[model samples]
Target: MWNKIEMKRWHRLFYDQLVRRWKQNIVFAAATIFFLQFLIVKLHPSEVQEFNEAQCADIYPKLKQGLISVNEGMRTLVGHELKLIGEKEFDVTGYTVKRPLLNCLDQEDELLHRTIKEKYFVKGNVSGRGFSKPYEELKHPYQTQDLLELVFKELRNGFYVEAGAWDSEQMSVSLLFEVGFNWTGILIEANPWDHQLGLLRNRNALYLNTCLGLTVRPQFSDFVFTPAVEVKEGQWMASMGGLSETLLNPDSIKLQCFPFYSILMAAGNPTVNLLILDIEGAEFAVLKTIPWNKVDIQVMTIETDLIGKAGISGGSQEEAREFIISKGYTLFKHRNNINPVTGLENNDLFIRNDIVKKWNIKFPEPLN
Candidate 1:
């Protein structure tokens, strides 16, 4: 009912107030977004370095003690997530997934994924075809065995000799090569309990219930056996197959021993494709006894940490490497990656230069 001039003025005033309010709201929204971005940048942490298993020795005890429950929990949770996502077989260990996952995972999944990303190198490729599990998802305590499998992905048949082959399948480096690659060889274990278990588990390989040394005997004494009488609940016992004579006590257990040369003769002196020697602390003595000229061993994995113990010398890493080099073998990989809590010794892998040339094989650098 107002006159035209009056109505026009009123409308302009109302429109002007609305425009001012809109501009104020825009400024407030921009300030809010800026504040949020600043908070995110300030609170975000730096990316964690890829965890080297060799460096994990210190953290292993905490994981075992449940002090760092998140690691175990993360493993189980990741395994569960894989199954839910229709992945029947996948490795949840510290070896999988090398890249960051920004928005591909949910909130909780993203957090756990980031935790793993911060610790391990993403080495897995899920889409590759004709590859039967780039690596074994389980069973191997470490990736050394699996990495060996990766190294020999070409060969169809070969021979292996596994010393200190605990329970044959449990942490047995030769098991995968034998089962997966159709290779055959010998398994040597001195522990009665472990030997019996190996017999039951490793049906494909020839099981030898004897120890390796420079001398063969129907029986040997003063070897330190584990599960000691003084072990407490939740406590563990330590036993190396052979230790320095100085370290052996009067109460040490007795076990049968044999010469490596005799074992080779019994096997018809076959060309050994791989030789895994892990006789605890006495590895070097047994290693020196091997007449490298007489045997044609292409590749060998030695647990050299045995030489690092007190009262154990002459079998030092330097001496061992020099001896193997003298025998025309080149160091392929030396795995010293150990967790401090476990005190696990490092292992060395060597390949004969002649055999490498013959087979046209390439060697990978030490993983540790």
Candidate 2:
């Protein structure tokens, strides 16, 4: 039989094998962002994104990647922790980490508190009823931000994990929690981290440029992203990002994928306050990777509409929904339109039944 010390040693070895070490400063990320911004105006950007999108502000502009060490363990494998698992089948040309090239950790607890007190006013406690915050100003497309506020109601100092965190600021669901409430989170994006290094360098979370999948073993998924539309030298358009099961674009990129549990395990699997999933149509597949019994999440917002529609496996979102609900979640809020917080369609909001009981959340039934 294995002893306790042996078990711990094995765990450390596993953590080391799963992650890589890197060094980069925020100065380079800032410079890159400045250059990318200049190029955005000079280049012909994709028509998909809106015109004049605001940039994502950093919390600690001077913090270094070395400061936020990848303290190998289950919970320590996020933010500054970005690496390929199993095998390195794909090219990591730009995957190199150096000053938020692909992985970033922005921590600003003290500054955030000062900003909240100086900039905004709160009339009541976060957990209390009739919470009002006219001074609270944060937003996301599709009413998602509103949903989080409505559900969590000013909850502070929580944890969030998001898949498909692109652009960092424009439509991020976890930004509000991070900047306003001092919450920590994990951002996973399949696009090159360098593309948005400028916008992502200051988030109070670990930002990654990888996709999520259901496979337990190491795998790869084809993604569609125009790193930038450079019309001429030094002139570039803003990046266009997306992921898919089918390789529709000839210029598609293949990104290495890791199971959801691998990420949580690396993070110490701390009780997740909010978990947002906007991984294009692979929601079902990615969610399948989680061992619900082992993970604890207070609330979840997932985008379900893609996958299983006409795939070879003939999977269905309904099956996914059933699988999740079977675990311990209650289908409380469901919407067909866009979520203001997540900026995704065909959304569903679920609260863990235990959370509902513990927090006394009274919600309506799921919509058809």
Candidate 3:
């Protein structure tokens, strides 16, 4: 109804207004999104971990409340406490009770190359195919540790891979076997001081001063190992190591990390006679990362209570049990031993089906 110029002017005005409003709306929306993102990041900063040795010291302070970093990550270094009174050379010829710790620097790699058959068969008291005697009950906190020792007592030079092997001998499931039976293997500890103590105690076994992990991804950055002030003298804060950084105090040390397979390779991929895994709460991750095809584990004693309790998998103990069974192992015993400190029932022992079949290893009458 209007003139041509008037119509054109009206159209232009309408189009301009529409574009301006649209632009303003878009800007508002974008600003809102940006503000929300900023608030989220600031309020709940996501954690990131890096595993660079060079960056280990530098990244500790920058780690948020919950963050970790790991890079590609062993050996027994003797502690100063156990002063070597006798000769430094480790010799188990007579099974002396008062033997001092020996430096395992040179002997670690050599032991890794030795298989279970070679060590136990050649050097051990393998009079029969396996132990024919009834399993004995020892003075151990959990009867399972002694039971495990008795199962393979006939095999000398037997090998064990103990994750989270704290103090080597103190409450160690494999300590009796190593000292009495002449077995040797690798002991992995996350705490630097404990690792040193492990080295001093376990001269026969190779000790690794690192944490075993599932993925190469770093877990927490700027993690300091700080235990609660109320922790008792003899008790160890399990969470102070590789389990959770949140509980660590300011004095905690950064842990060197590695994958399970990587650790096996470093240990020359020996055939594992026994695998004792108690890596705080990261047992699931370590179990998941194990290269089943590469090694033959005859017996495994693992802490199962923390399986899906934490970490990314959110997996449960039943799921963990099922997973282990799926990997050629049978749940032999659910010990359900309550940890003296935490009072949590966590110990579960599994035996390789093939080993049980081959050796005809029958379940002994329950001692408990």
Candidate 4:
């Protein structure tokens, strides 16, 4: 199976210090196809004859008949050509034929935890026993573990979309839902942390190593990630970068950028149960991009502390709160506590109005 393949080559590229210093955004196509033929368990590309101008139209029918095998690894790539999302439709004649060459030079991406249960994931609260999967194992900075369980009555096999998902394991608000509840979803993280302790490789979620922006389309942006730690003696890992409206230095690390709505569409627009944002104050802008009417997100948790911080989103928590409330979400839960250990701000959980109406969740009262 594709999931069984060991993605050592792919992980190395993502984690390599040199690539971190040089190329941050890996081209989409080559990332999946570079070693696919060699590693796809005896599945090789079905070669087709070279196409001249005369044979241009012939590529269409051959592609229709599965004469070529570029069908694999075309996810989240080529907006104009593949039409994964946007006004354009899949242009078999224009784009399908170039898969062979593009695959050779595509950037590196490896889908981890596919065809397997999430690591350390349990079927239920099987904690405290021998070889048991404990509850509340993966702790979020904002106590989302308790928040989620209380809200859902310990619901399992749910779905989530976690932006700023750091390293799948540490302080990830979404991993506990996956590992403890057997839920699977998306994990979006970007650079600096990706270089330091970022870019998930073990979690069962679909990993997108990109930054979220308030955009109508998928694009690249300069990710200004300042490492909160030192790499060596008298040397810091702080590289100059900028956020959406950041007043930072000229030098910034460029990473793959996409709007929140576009990313949901790229991920097949699944109904997101819990949308958690902890991307260092980029939450407001990213949240604005989600097409609230089309996408059904039941609940959201945002780091509200960074709202008024200069060089961040340049917006206040009131603005963020107003924007969210306007989107038909009611502030479902909030606790007053800036996390001491991780220094994480308190996350305000907002439940969609429709969901609140459907579930009839009353604050501080258990649902029967």
Q: Which candidate tops lDDT?
A: 1
Q: How many clashing pairs in candidate 3? A: 21
Tens-digit lDDT track of model 1 for 144-263 = 443454356647678888888765665567766766777788887765445554554534667765566443211233355421211234543344435345655432343334557656
Better of 1 and 2 by TM-score: 2
Give one digit per residue, the lDDT tens place, for model 3 in 1-368. Answer: 11112322354565467567767799865864564354334322223223455464444443322243111121112211221212352321110010011111111223222321232111222232121122242233353344554466467778888887765654467766765677888777765556644454424666665566555422332223322211234543323334543454333333325566655665667788888887645677667766687677898888766554433245666777788888988776544355444344556777788887787766643212
Residue range with the least summed lDDT across 10 consecutive positions in model 3: 94-103
TM-score of each: 0.55, 0.56, 0.56, 0.56
Task: Please identify model 1 stretches exceeding 4 Å from their true place.
Answer: 1-138, 141-150, 216-219, 227-241, 308-313, 334-345, 365-368
Tens-digit lDDT track of model 2 for 1-368 = 11112322354565344333312556655754565454333222232121121211231243233333222111101112122322332222243121221122211223322322332211222332121122243245443554554677788889888777754554567766766778877777666643244132356565555566546533445555432222234543322345555434443544545567666665556899888886545778767667787788888887654435311134555777787888888876543354222233455777788887887766455542
lDDT by candidate, in order shown: 0.51, 0.50, 0.50, 0.49
lDDT for position 288 in model 1? 69
Model 4: per-residue Cα lDDT over 1-368, one tens digit each: 11000222233344366355445556643553443322222221234223344443554445445575433333222111121112333322111111221122112111111111232111222232221123334235544644565566687888888776654554567666776688888776664334223221345656665566555433345454332222233432232123545544332333435566655655667888888877655677777766677788888877765554524545666788888998888874454444332243346778887787787777743111
Error of 3 at 81 (Å): 12
Q: Note the clash tally of each candidate.
A: 8, 19, 21, 4
- Cα error, residue 23 of model 3, in Å, equals 62
